[model samples]
Target: MFKIKKQISKLYMASILGNLSLTGAWVAILAARGYSLVEIGIAETVFHIFSLTFEIPSGVFADVFGRKQMLVVSSIMRVIGSICMICSKNLTMVCAAIACFAVSYNFSSGSGDALAYDSLKLVGEEARYERYAANQLILYRLCNGISTLCAGFALFVGYKIAYASDVLVTCIQIGVLLSLREIRLDHTGTDRKQEVLQSVWKELRVCFVESLRFLKKAKRAVFLMICNSFVGAVDIVLLFFLQAKLPQTGMPDSALGSSLFIMEMGGILGAKLILWCKNLRYRWVFAVTSVLVLCGVLIEHTGIAVLMTLGGFVAACSDDALQVRTDAILQEMFPSEQRATLISMESFTFSVIMIALSPLAGIVFSVW
Candidate 1:
């Protein structure tokens, strides 16, 4: 029980480090380094491409190998990526950095939640999964808020410093991760190598088949996943270009951090509010919040900083709400045996959507 608590703490801390990037200043910094809006979009495309390629394989590997070890590898990859992002001055370097970032993200995608859920199950606390997931989301957004709040000041000092902070945080996350124990629910009592190998193969095959079966039969789950993925794509695109868009809205570059901080705060609040919204239908929550997101994006160029910031806040809040609700639905829909793989499918779909839309987003932003 104590160990489970410790793992939960480490997961929360690592989640904070993971989400806490340079916030709104990354685009500005990249632009200052001579990257056009299109170039920035291409870099992001590179990210999703790598993610789309490795996302499911990594998840399968986690279910077969071990989640804790994969998480360690993820931290190492993120550290390398952050270093690259900090040192890079050109598009090629940024693409390399984003590639590493994508690998890191793909590796860790569904593993964390799977680990947490399995840990709770081992301790007879499986019922706490939704609450735990929600709390994790809140903590993740809280870190985003902290990162954004400091990003402008970091930029005031130097872009290198802002980017370097991500490296430092990831390093700390690695240290926390090292303390986590691997929880294998399907641990075999026998130490026979051949039998273990066969068992792993069988589990992998079952995981794949079950995932497909779920997709074919679960229409509600598919629809929810589509809505979640769409909102996620829009949120990510807006976040990537928002720093660039601020200038067009008559906002100074220096205000980027504060603007991002406001959005993060909204996300944090929305995540926290999900506790009260458990009774609400997921579709209704999605429909209402998605409309707000659409409106926010439509009016993003209204040339009012306050209005733009408010729109950003609304969009961020909606994304968080949709994410938390959709995740809960997925958790309930998938069996524990196929949890990681199914969640990874959702992530893979989102990545593919993002990859397809990235270049178009770049073109739109560049033309605008």
Candidate 2:
């Protein structure tokens, strides 16, 4: 048997490197290229549309091919996307870059946790998946927080320079992925061979059928999944547009990365706080944190940059808490067999909502 903890540690490192993409300045980069708010929205909408379309298919591919392989594919896509963003000078190229990012994200989403949980199960540490998951989330926010801070500093140099840094980090992440050994757990002797023989169309149908059956019994999880989608979509719009919105509140452009970095720092602390107080009920914590997030967003709408910055911090903290809680609950609700497929379904819902709402948000900003 392979070392489960060792694999988890490797995955954690990869997650950190993968997210350190100077993300705080993505919208700013496009804006710097002269893309209007509406055009930026259109690009995101295209991303969501392509993402929703490919999300499930990619998840199915992960299940059949192997999660480690899918992650490697994701890293490659991210590298290509980063290159596109670095070289982009117009709307078409930026949109193409966003599409690559969308595809890359879908490939990584369900597979990482599925791979981690399966590894734990293989080593008889399956029961500790919740704790393992919590650690992963903590690392994710912590890395993102650090990257955002650095990204702000990099922004002083140039937006392209920041994106170039992101590309280099992503390339290193691929090396991390290369070190992960793929674990194929097949009880039945012929499962792998059978999968190879099955047509792609058949695999798609099987994944869909199995997922629907599980969703039928897991109503609460289903509801949470849908709600998470809406919340996530709104959060994405707010996150991307936040830097742009700050100028109206008398905030200077140079401080945008710092503000975003601070907000991400708050999320890291919130995640750590959840780990510190593990006795808290997930349901109650999720409810309370979500409400706080809503309040923060509403306050942000008031056009006061300082208040908006504080609101962003509050929103980031609460949102991170909510995500940790939701991930735990969903882990409890679904068995390992269908975990990745179910998670992909949830992401598909999120993309659909973003596709519908992103354009409207763009229009409102454009008109303003």
Candidate 3:
């Protein structure tokens, strides 16, 4: 039990370290580099395209081999991505870098949560996974917020320096990841012998088939994933565009970091706030958050700097609240053996939505 608690604590530390990147405001950096909205949209689409392709396969690898292994791969990909971005001098190079980032994201997305939840499950503390999930979200939001607060420094120092700093942080994160203990689900009797006899391809095939079978029967899980992902995609698009849009509202470059930081605090708040909504039904939670997100969109379209920032904040807040709740519900529904793959499917859903939304949102924001 003590070791399990320590492991969970380490996961929290890893989350903080992983998210603390000097180049967190990549959209703003690209805009400052003079990329047009259409070009930036293309870059984002490139990312989701690779993400869509790799999400499930990466998850299958985690389930078949080990979650810890996939996370290490994620860190290495991040380092490579940062280096590529540092060397990038054209949109094509930027797209290549973004594809590396997408691969990094794919490897990490479901692996961490699977590792954490299974670790807790070993100790019969699975009920606490929701709290852990919320805390992880808080750490992610706060760390990313701090990184965004460094936007001015990142901008002043330039992309090479900013990306180099990210490489350094990722290296440290890799060291942290190396120290994590891998959790394996227990298989007994005939199942144990079957596991020993199964080839890697067989294991992967089983995990994939099981995940698909589970999803087919678990319609509620699929619905929850789609709804949560849609709201998240919308909020993310608004926040990403705000990095470029805020400046055009006459806000000085000096305040850009602070504005973006303030907007991220909404996510932190939402993560915390969802814990208080334990009594609310999932339907009510989804409905309310969806409406709030749309309200944020309406608010952002006003084109006033203050209102737009508020819009980003509201959207982020609502998005995180729904995300935490949905993750908790889905984690409970998933079987341990197929956990990571199923979660990756949820991410696959998000990537699809992001691929569809990002380009259109970019053009609309660019025109407006």
lDDT of 2 by residue, 1-368 (tens): 57777899899999988887665567765665577889988998999998999898888778767788889899888878878877887788888988999999999999998888778767767678777776776776667666655544655667677777777888898899889976655542112222464487776678678878888987888888876676666666776677667655676666776777777766766666776767887667767777877777677788877788787787777777667667767866765556677778889989989998888988875655
Off by over 4 Å in 3: 187-194
Instruction: Kindly report the root-mean-square deviation of model 1 from the true structure over all alpha carbons.
Output: 3.0
Models 1 onward score TM values of 0.91, 0.90, 0.97
Report lDDT (Cα) of residue 132, candidate 3: 94
| Clash pairs for candidate 3 | none
> What are the per-residue Cα lDDT tens digits for candidate 1 across 197-275?
6577777777688778978999888888888999978876876677677766666656777787787777877777777
Worst 10 contiguous positions by lDDT, candidate 3: 186-195
- The Cα local distance difference test for each model comes to 0.78, 0.76, 0.90
Candidate 3, after superposition: displacement of residue 67 in Å?
0.4
How does candidate 3 score on lDDT? Answer: 0.90
Question: Candidate 1: worst 10 consecutive residues by lDDT?
Answer: 186-195
With candidate 2 superimposed using the best TM-score fit, by how many Å does residue 168's alpha carbon deviate from the native? 2.3
TM-score of 3: 0.97
Off by over 4 Å in 1: 21-24, 186-195, 198-206
